[model samples]
Target: MHTPADSAVAIQGLHKKFKESHALCGVDLQVRQGEVLGLLGPNGAGKTTLVKILTTLLKPDSGHVLVNGWNVTADPEKIRSTIGMAGQYSTVDGLLTGFENLYLIAKLRGVGRRTARRNAEDLLARFRLSGVAGRPAGTYSGGMRRRLDLAAALVGSPPLVVLDEPTTGLDPESRLDTWDAVGELVAGGTTILLTTQYLEEADRLADRITVIDAGRVVADGTSDELKAAAGNRLVVCVAEDHQLDAAARAAARATGVTPMVDRRARRVEAAASDGPAALGRALTALEDEGVQVLEIGLSRSTLDDVFLGLTGRARHRAA
Candidate 1:
C-alpha cells in the first residue's frame, strides 16, 4: 500500500493558474524515499511553480501534495522544517564566511551554538570548503559559493533536499564538483528532488525522471527507459546547408516522424523505431532527392532525444 514512508514527495491532480494562463494542469509525480527525482521541463513549464508549491512559497490552485507524508496544505511548517532547498541563485549571506553561513543556519534551526559549529565544520569538510571556511562567501569563487549554498541547505540534515537548477551557471569543473556533492548526499540516503534543464544532469543523477511541458505531465521513467521509448535516432548530415530541407523531408519520410533540423550543422535527426529499415529508407530517399549525404547512421537515442520527442524542443544545456 502507498503510504507516507514510501514517497518523499507525492502530488495528485495538481493544478495552478496565474490569471488566464495555466501554470500547472492536473500534474502528478512522486519521488521515492532515498532516491533522486529529476523534474525536467522547458522554461515556463510549471517547474518553478511546482517548486514554489512544494517549498510552501506558493499555494496550488487545487491539488494534493504531500512531502514526507505530511499534506502541504495542512502542514507547511512541518514540511519546511524537514526539507532543505537550494535554488538556482545562492541564498547565503555574502557577509558571512563559509563556516558562518552554515553555522548560522544550524543555529536558526535550533541547534545549540556548539553543535552548530560542529555541523558547520563537518559540512565545510564534506564539500571541500574547509580550506576557505573563514573567507567571506562573497569573496569565494562561484563554485565555492555554490558549495557553501549547498552546505547551508543541509544545515539541519533535512531528509529531503530540493535542488532547483543547482548547477546552472557553473564552469564545467565546478559543475562536476556540485554533482559529486549531490552523489554524496544520495549515498548518505537523502531524498532529492532535482529540477534541471541540463539533460546530462538528469541523465546521470536521477533515479527516475518526470518530464512536464505546457503545464502537463508528459513522460516519466528511468533515463534508459525514456531513451528506449524514444527509439533510435536516424541522423543524416548533408554535405551542404542548402540540402537541409530535402534531408528533413527524407528523414520524415524514412521515420514517419518530423525531423529536427540543425542548419548550422547541416544535420537532420528523427526518431526511428525500426532502425535498419529506417536507415535503408533514408538512404533511398536521399538518393532520390539528389541530396548529398555526408553521413548517415542509426544511433541509440539519447536523453536529449527523448526530451525533444516529448516536448517538441531541445533543452538548452550549459557548457
Candidate 2:
C-alpha cells in the first residue's frame, strides 16, 4: 500500500497511444519510497513507456503522473533532478574511460570539476571497476561496461532510479553483481523501479511486482500474493513404465483432477490445492490400487507457473 507521503512515483489512469496501437491503457501504479517495485512483462508490454512517462521523457496522452510530489508534465526539470534512468541499452560513451564517463555525467548534472571527479572515483570504486577505471568503455567487457553505465546513472545520487532491463545481456555472474549493486542502492534508501523480462530477477529483488500485458496492468502484488492468486500446486511422481498410466488414473481419481503423464520419465503429475497432503493421498490411492510409485514429492508453484496461469502465456512465450 502507498500513502501520498510515502510515494515517490504515482500514476493514475494513464493512457497513451501510437496510431492504432494503444501503448498504455488507463495504467495506475504507485511506488513507495525506498522500495523496489518491479515492472514485468513481455516486449511491447509498455514497461518502458511507463518509465519514460515517470522520468518525463515521454508525455502521457491522458491521466496524471507525479514523481517526488511533482507533476511530470508541469515539472519535468524538477523530476529529472530527483531521478536517475538507465535504459535497456548501455548509454556510456564508448570512447570514454569508465572514470571519464562517470565524470561527464556528473558534470552534465551540474557538479563542479572537483566534485565530479570525486563522485566518479567513488562510484567506480563502489562498483568494483576501480582497476579498470582508465580503460575505455569500448575496451571493457560487457559486464564492466554495464557496471560503468550503472555508475554513470548514479553519479547524481538521485532518490529514485529507473532500471530498464539493466542486466539483459550480462552473464549470470555479472547479473549477480548487478543485483548486489541494486541491493546496496536500495539498502541505502534509494527507491528503484525496475522493468525486466526476467521473472527470477523480479522474484529475487522486488518488494512488489506489477505485471503488465497489452499496455495494461493485469496484476500487481508481492510475489507470494500473486502466486496465491494464481492458485494450485502440482505434485509429480515417477512410476514403472508399464504402470505409469494406471498410477496417473489413480491419482486423478483421488484428487478429482486429470493427471498428466510425462512419457519421457514415466511420471504421473497432478494439480491440487494442498500439494503435500495431496501427494500423500495420491500415494495412498496408488498403493490401494496396487500401483507402484518409484518416487514422489510436493512442490509449490513457481512464478513461471503463476505468469502462465494469469496471462495464458508462458513468461518466455514469444510476443
For each candidate, the alpha-carbon lDDT, in order, equals 0.90, 0.84
How far residue 20's Cα lies from its native spot in candidate 1, in Å, is 4.1
Measured against the true structure, the TM-scores of the candidates, in listed sequence, are: 0.89, 0.91
**Model 2 stretches astray by more than 4 angstroms:** 251-260, 274-289, 317-319
Clashing pairs in 1: none
Write candidate 2's Cα lDDT for 102-129 as tens digits: 9989999999999999999999999999
Q: Give model 1's TM-score versus the native structure.
A: 0.89
How close to the true structure is residue 127 of candidate 1, measured as C-alpha lDDT? Answer: 95
In candidate 1, position 282 carries an lDDT of 93
Give a tens-digit lDDT track for model 1, residues 1-319. 2577899998999999999989999999899998999998887888888998999989988999999989999999999999999986899999988988899899899999899999999999999999999989999988888888888888889999999888888999889989999998989899999998888999989999999998999999999899888888899999988889999998999999898898888899888999999999999999999999999998999988788789888887655
